[model samples]
Target: MTTGRLLIVMNAGAGHSQAEASRAAIRAVLDAHGRAYQFFLADSGSALPQQAALAVQQALAEGGAVIAAGGDGTLNTVAQAVLPHSLPFGVLPLGTFNYFARAHGMPEDIKAATEALLSARIQPVQVGLLNERIFLVNASLGLYPTLLEDREAYKAQYGRSRLVALWAGLVTLWRARGRLRIVLEHDGQRSKLRTSMLFVGNNALQLAQLGLPSAQQVEQGALAALALRRTGLFTVLLLLLRGAIGQLHTADKVLHFTFQRISVRPRLPYGRRRIKVATDGEVGWMSSPLVFAVAPQPLLLLCPATMETPA
Candidate 1:
């Protein structure tokens, strides 16, 4: 959409050989289309913010757009850097599920996705902010973070795929036994509750696929929270099946709500201050009283014109 040029950032953490293969494939598509672009290869997670910030600065100065060319985590990295600049941002879906990209009609096929990026229009799309970080898909606390941690480990050992991800999740759930005692505050109301997983969703498509109630409210500027009640192992397995088949709405034990802003504070007796959190599948520790809210300014994204809700 920005006719100036393009700055594409690739998540090169997947290993040098594999990353280069994907890079070459993407380069072929862009070259065949005669698009003007440059690449920023992120060899490590810790360096992404610094590298992406440099790329974003250069793109902004050149009146061009910046593109995130991998999965949700990669997008999260590039987005954090670009959001501060207020320039048009783009995505090249290369991640499993591709939730954020698919919700905006981004094609999953490489050639199709490349073509869409070439002629996409600048559109303002809403995103969730986990404290000071940007999460385009979702953010969560409790068991979900553990699941992401295990998933990455499995990917390291068994390779990346849907089956491996599912296996990792099942293992985590089977071993999951802890309950979070927290004070949840939202909508000027507060409550104390115990739960295994506390998930806050921002992407309508992902929530809709999970058969969560009020999934569409996310597009209406509200986030949906799902709290899993502590249950027997068999019941938890049943819940997983339901979620997989888009029947989670039938689970009576799950608590669901919609809100504009929410705060979570862990009530630990030992004065523990940090808790593990997952934003768009990346897990890390953050101070308690985590705040999840819609960003005051929407992200300026490049998407095909056929999208229904581009602002």
Candidate 2:
């Protein structure tokens, strides 16, 4: 709510519903509030991060907030761009989970989220980083990234519903294979583990929903590391059920811990130095010795008054 205008960065891939309808509702809210705003739409997937970064540059120069009007992935891109500049950021969730939005008390309904933006205030929100990359929600290695790929494929082929996501996850788990022998170092302690997946949670809502013991720790600015000890298809499926029903905390085969920083060195196959990693639903590769840590500086996110932040 500065004197400057709002820079809205929208991802064209947000096919959650009618894109035009979401745009119209957002425009209606801003117009009703008499707010000055500009939209920078990312028409193609390849240019989304660049577009968001461009919006951030403009917002930084003009003294305004950059609003991401898509899903968590879009939010992550905008956050990554805004993090370096210490600019105010906003979100209008159009994703399936909307964990980052909902965890911060943001309404997923486009019009309502936009309306909240009109009266929102800036707060320092926690951020997680995989090396230099920013992740607003959670980050994972191994099967989760593969599952995300399958989920996107399923979403494209069928639809973007929870059922579809769940189906994709089931299929991925059933087909899951291989173990990652990772040497983890954190807080002057070292451990070697062989697991099918290593999941680091930065969002309290998602962690709490999963009944993870480290959820409160995540809320308090620490990241939770969860690893699956067994990768057998049936065991993986049962673990998935436990996670789905918020009983992961009770599972014996899952290793859970809290950390502010952790180093992961995966024992890879010959000539392979990179591995696929997923952050907030976007998958990519990072070099060996992937380090997951709480960003030194928190993101200045615009949130409604109902949202709370740690002091």
Candidate 3:
């Protein structure tokens, strides 16, 4: 394939120094290859430039690709704008955790990643949408979303330290184990459950070490739902331990199901209070009564030929 026009969208404020370094590396690669490209920067990664979508559209009009150079959230924003136009997308994996990029087998080495992008095979992947908002990885609620919000606060204070975010999550998990009443409908079954956390995955997660059944089984054509009913602190801790040790299993307290769509209404009135949510590590506060569905084959992702490989 020929090297085409590329537009690089970067989140300059995401990881501060780290983002800057990644930007420099990207520029170096572009210079080395003498490739034609355009650079656009967003201060906080929250505000999308009015011209961003147009720029990508213009690139695609001329048969080009747009590269997202931050974390998954950045990719989600860019994807929302570009995918509908059938524009090919690339990722630079410059966030604290590059889950989407890593999962897709993009290289972590900046130069090599750039080279891979220049020669990588492209595949169409399914993306999930929550009330029209696109999520590249998963749309989750309950404790995970709460923890995501908490993690954001720690990231603001401690920068991109994963340890800091993990510590903050642990603290929040211990103090506020708020139970959410959820009504889940899957496979023609409607059930009500009180749970501390509910995870609805766009794709199954690999849990090789955890002798438990693989969550990856849910990735086929439907959405995978995992709900935890246990509210006791000790029980929660034990579950966490099991997850850490890859020994967690689907049990009565933990309900796992797969479906084409789901609607979540919290029993507690959300009012003006927003529920926390994260899409590909881009954290935000959203209103309750969330609806999520699979947007099957919505994104054209650049992945390595060996799909199972991780960057």
Candidate 4:
């Protein structure tokens, strides 16, 4: 049970049309649990990271836990605040894809998640950093980030759905051109490669799909990196075929590896020393050369008492 007041920072746009209903359900569950908590509904138009940071500061001052009530992106914003202070954090998975919540063994249903939070146990979970920005899932450069950019626009115009996302990916792949030249340094080794895509995995499920053995234990304080080794049209087609058949890791043109930290630099740098990067489905620009590392201190995530950390 929450020993002190719990601060909840909710994103107004997270649940879309059902945002209100979700909020009511959360309130009812918390009240039934007799938890002392305060609510802060983040303005949809305001900068979420800033708003969440302020809310986190308030929660720390009140000597309580902070709960992020929304999808992975919303959780990421709240995490930015909690991480600096090394505060305990909770999550309410009210999103289309509850990747981070599911990774932590959080139930999808709101009432169930609430109950889990009430009798929660704190676990230190690893988080990945891109130029020091925390990301709970994966980060990517090249074709994948390009696909994310397309998917966001498509979702805006046609609404979000699995079918819509697939359509967006196809459209993006058809239009993508050329290869990326990057210098990647892992451990004490460094190499220059030309490829169409690169992905750094922090989520176990995604890593498993890429056939990495480390997917079984994501919190082992490491990262799985995947890169397409060839950029030719035929190589791209072969990678797509292998991916469709669940043989991506076995494909000759794909490189899959694990690391505790890595750095990436683009051959053609952007002005102002910045480069485009995507993490946990959110895209932004960060200063180059992008350095990714596993945080030294794991995040204190509140999970169900019965939940076991994934192995």
**In lDDT terms, which candidate is top?**
2
Clashing pairs in 3: 210-246
Question: How close to the true structure is residue 141 of candidate 1, measured as C-alpha lDDT?
Answer: 90
- By lDDT, rank the candidates, best first: 2, 1, 4, 3
Clashing pairs in 4: none
Question: TM-score for all predictions?
Answer: 0.96, 0.97, 0.88, 0.92
| Residue range 1-311, candidate 1, lDDT tens digits | 57867898887886567678778877898899888889988788777888798788888789989988888998998998898779899998888889989999999886688788888988898889889888999899988999999999999899889999999999998898888888988878899888888998988898888898677788888888998887777888899889889989889878889887899897765877888899999998888779988889889999987776644
Task: For candidate 3, write residues 1-311 as lDDT tens digits.
Answer: 33678788887876678777877888788889888888777777666544357568767678878888876778788888887776778888776666678767887777778877877666777777776688876777778877887788887888767788778878887888578887765556677888888876664443333333534554455666667885687787777777777766744467666666887766666445567776666567677667778775567777766664211
lDDT of candidate 1 at residue 106, scale 0 to 100: 91
**Model 3 spans > 4 angstroms off:** 49-51, 203-214, 250-252, 270-275, 285-288, 305-311
Per-residue lDDT over 1-311 for candidate 2, one digit per residue giving the tens place of the 0 to 100 score: 44568899887656735777898898888888899999988876667888888898899788988888877888898888888898888999988889999988889888889888888888898999998898989999988999999999999999889999999988887777778899999989899999999999899889988898788888788999999995688888788789889999998999999999999999999999999999999999999899999999998888887777662
Candidate 4: tens digits of C-alpha lDDT, residues 13-45: 654567788878888988987888887777672
Against the true structure, candidate 2 reaches a TM-score of: 0.97
Off by over 4 Å in 2: 1-3
Best by TM-score: 2
Segments in model 4 whose C-alpha atoms lie over 4 Å from true places: 232-246, 269-272
Number of colliding residue pairs in each model? 0, 0, 1, 0
What lDDT would each prediction earn against the true structure? 0.86, 0.88, 0.71, 0.80
